[model samples]
Target: MLTNRNILLCVGGGIASYKAAALASKLVQAGANVQVAMTKNAQQFVGKTTFAALTRKPVYDDVFIEHDASKIAHIDLADEADLIVVAPATANLIAKLANGIADDFITTTILAATCPVVVAPAMNVNMLEHPATVRNMERLMADGVQLIAPGVGNLACGWIGKGRLPEPEELVETLSGLFQAKKLENRHVLISAGPTIERIDPVRYLTNDSSGKMGIALAEAARDAGALVTLVHGPIRGTLPSGITTIDVESGDEMLEMMLTHYDQQDLVIMAAAVADYRPTVTYDRKQKKIDGPLRIELEETTDILRTLGERKTTQVLVGFAAETENLEHHAQQKLIRKQADFIVANDVSRADIGFSSDENQVTVYGKDETVTPYAQQSKTTLAQNLIKQFAEALR
Candidate 1:
């Protein structure tokens, strides 16, 4: 699938640098045009000759060296690259790239490259835990760089922890996904997001902490995969992406009505919104003033949109989400069965660092067949991309 794609592999100085050689070989054997570049310190562990012999191209390490004599090597390499990958990315290399300190050929070429860049961090556990390294990784990710996060295991330094480069086999799959085919082409996707507000009075309402980022991310991903998306969202503080249909709603009933109206036309339905379970039995025309020491408000169950859709659905894949504080997988499995959903995206809202308002999430996807897929903490955008890809596969 990666045939004819020009991939530049940048190897930083680390014990994990050896694994990069295998990655380059894998890409080359998979029909990718791989070019190897190494740092000065990287050459200490893996000789420049070794990479040249493997890639059948000169290994680049210096910005001063001119490979073509006319074109600057760094610029030429950067211009030809369709994608650049940094395997065994040491803390220094990460910091340098994040701070724009391009003093070496590897860094300089990366600075000149306009293509997508993916980083696989490899360092000591302590170094990875350092605040500086953490900030650098976050900054890189924020700058639109993809991260193939490190794996957890025994390290060469005798301390077992994260910071180990993911095996070359896994890296290959992640890179392939960068250019995966758009399996969702021509498909219509319907998505619901954010927390639905059930009005009590003009001044107050009942809602959850959902910020709607997950649903929005999925909508964008679906659009990117060539699917037409309609986003039914609640009142939330975020901008909508262009090229997709967007509907605003306040209550669960409103969202349900809109969804059902458009349901038959969709190929996939993702119920991601944190819809209110109950709404006030009675709503006053005006804000109620504090007249008594205690006020009683009766509640009524709102519409069960997922269950309703499951019953009404035909020739469409139904997906639901479960946001729980405990027994996530158990709850997700039950929901998957109860709602007759094909899959349920379940997450523990208990983690303060992720879910709801956070930019990242960790979730386990439960399928009706009892199959489960777990995804670790990552940006919602990344997670959505993966989910959309998998969803497309499920359709096949």
Candidate 2:
């Protein structure tokens, strides 16, 4: 996937900077046209000559050094890159980028870059956990920078925790996935997100705690993967991606109608919405006043949208989500079979730390023929990217 692609590798000032050299070599072996840029501190650990020898390209170290008299060095590199990778992203560098500091060659080039930027952080465990560093990392993610999470192991600082750089091979594979994100190009993906509202009265409604973050993440992930994505969501807490088609609905029935309307044209359908299973038999038009005594209303079952789509699926790959508090695996397996879905992504909503409205999630994917794939807890964005990649492979 990296074949002939232009990758700008930015090495930060850290012990893991040595690994950045290996990463550059591996990227070159993978057929990528790698251009290395180093911070002043990074050159202390690995000289610019080493990078130039590895990538066989002139190392870009000084922003003022314009090899071409007419073209600005940083601007030229920024404009030509297909992707920018910041390996061994030190706390200093992370803070700099997060705050828009462009004093150095690397930071300046990155500031001018419009392409996708991937950051691989490596630092002392204590520094990694520092409030300032944590805030900076979060800011980077909020700015749409892709993070290759640091590993947990013995650090060069002699402290043991989660600030080690990933192995070169793993980094290469993840980078390759970034390029292969276009695997779903020309394919149409339909994703449903958020919690459907089941109205009891004009003023009050029944809804789950879903914030639609996961579903929105999935939509963005698929869109980044080059799929024509359509997001059908109930009342969501967040804004939708600009490029994708977004349809808003208030109830499960409305969601079902929208899904059915677009089902035939979809290459893949992911039922990520927390659709209501029941609604009041009669929705009160006016706000009901305080009742004198216990009042009861009839409840009716709403349509099972996932099962309906599964049954109607012809060439489309149907996927369902099971938000269970107990028996996660069993319930996911049951849903996969009963709903006739190709895969069931199951997560425990009981965990206050991960699922529900949180940004992180841990899910187990259940497939037909008794296949189960368990994924570790991570950010919803990362999980969505991984899942979309798997689905793209399946579709291919």
Candidate 3:
């Protein structure tokens, strides 16, 4: 997939800089035009000559040194790159990138690059865990930067923790995976996201605290996989993603309508929305005034959209999401059978850190064949990419 691709490898100042050189070689061997950019401190660890020899391209290290007088070197590199990867990203480099401080050659070029930016952070464990670093990294992720999370092992600083750069081979695999040929090319995907609002009255409604980040992330991931994605969403907390068909609905019934409307044309259907399971049995058309006593609302079950879709699925890969507070895998497995879904993605919503309204999530996927895959806590975006790829493969 990396054949004939232009990859910008930005090296940072860290012991892991050596690994970056190896990574450049691997990318070149995979048929990518690898261009290397190094920070001043990175030159100390791995000389520019080493990278030049491996990539057979000039290694850029200075912002002022322009080989061509006509075009700005940084801008030219940024414009030509298909992807930008900052491996062995030191704490200082990360901060600089996060804050848009372009003092160095690498930082300046990265700032100018509009392509996807992937960062692999390598630093001391303490520096990795510092509040400022954490905040900066979060900002970068929020700004749509892909993060290759550091591994946990013995560090160059002699501290044992999660600040080690992954091996060259692993880095190459991960980076190559990012540019994989679109598995869902020309396929149609239907995704539902956000919280369904069940109205009790004109001014009152019942809804969960779902922010729709996961669903939106899934839509983006599916789109990136080259699918014609149609996103059926509810009231989302953030801006909706572009380059897809997005239909806004307020209640489960509306979402159901949108999903079923696009169901027959979809190759894959993912029910990621936090749909309200129940709605008021008696809904008031007008806002009711405060009663002297506590008012009660009788509720009825909403249509099970996932089960409906699963029943109708013929050539489609059907996936369901189960948000459980207890007995997660059991509930997911049960849902898989009951809903007749090919896979059930279950997550513990009880965790304060990684579910519902949060940027990160951890999910266990339960397949119909009793295959259970537990994914650790990670950004919803990354998880969505993995899930979309798996679903697309299953569809094929």
Pick the lDDT winner: 2
Q: In model 1, where do residues sit more than 4 Å from their true spots? A: 186-267, 271-305, 308-316, 321-334, 345-387, 394-396
Model 2 steric clash pairs: none
- Worst ten-residue run, lDDT, model 3? 236-245
**Model 1, span 1-396: residue lDDT tens:** 689899999999999999998898899988899999899899888898888878898888888878888899999999999999999899999999998888999889988989989998999989997989988887886676766657666999999766778888778877886787788889999999999999999999999999998998898789868899999999887357667899999999999999999999999999999999999999998999897678889999999999999999898999999999988877888898889999999999888767598767889999887789999876676778889988898887
Candidate ranking under lDDT, highest first, comes to 2, 3, 1
**TM-score of predicted structure 1:** 0.68
Q: Higher TM-score: candidate 1 or 2?
A: 2
RMSD of 3: 5.3
Against the unseen true structure, what C-alpha lDDT does each candidate score?
Answer: 0.88, 0.89, 0.88
lDDT of 2 at 326: 97
Candidate 3 regions with alpha-carbon error over 4 angstroms: 1-5, 10-62, 68-72, 86-174
> Which digits, one per residue and each the tens of the lDDT, describe model 2 over residues 1-396?
999999999999999989999999999999999999999999889999999999988998898898889999899999999999999899999999999999989999999999999999999989987989988887887788877767766999888767888888878877887777487898999999999999998888888899898898889889888999999999975346657899999999999999999999999999999999999999988999998989887889999999999889899988999999998988889889999999899999998757677767899988885778888877676788889987887798
Write down the TM-score for model 2: 0.73
Give the CA lDDT, 0 to 100, for residue 281 in model 3: 91
- Model 3 lDDT per residue over 1-396, tens place: 789999999999898999998899899999999999999899899999999999988999999999899999999999999999999999999999999999989999989999989898999989998989988887887787877767666988898767888778767766776798889999999999999999988889999999898898898889888999999999985456667889999999999999999999889999999999999998989998887988778889999999999889898889999999999877898899999999999999998667686666899898987888888776576678878878887887
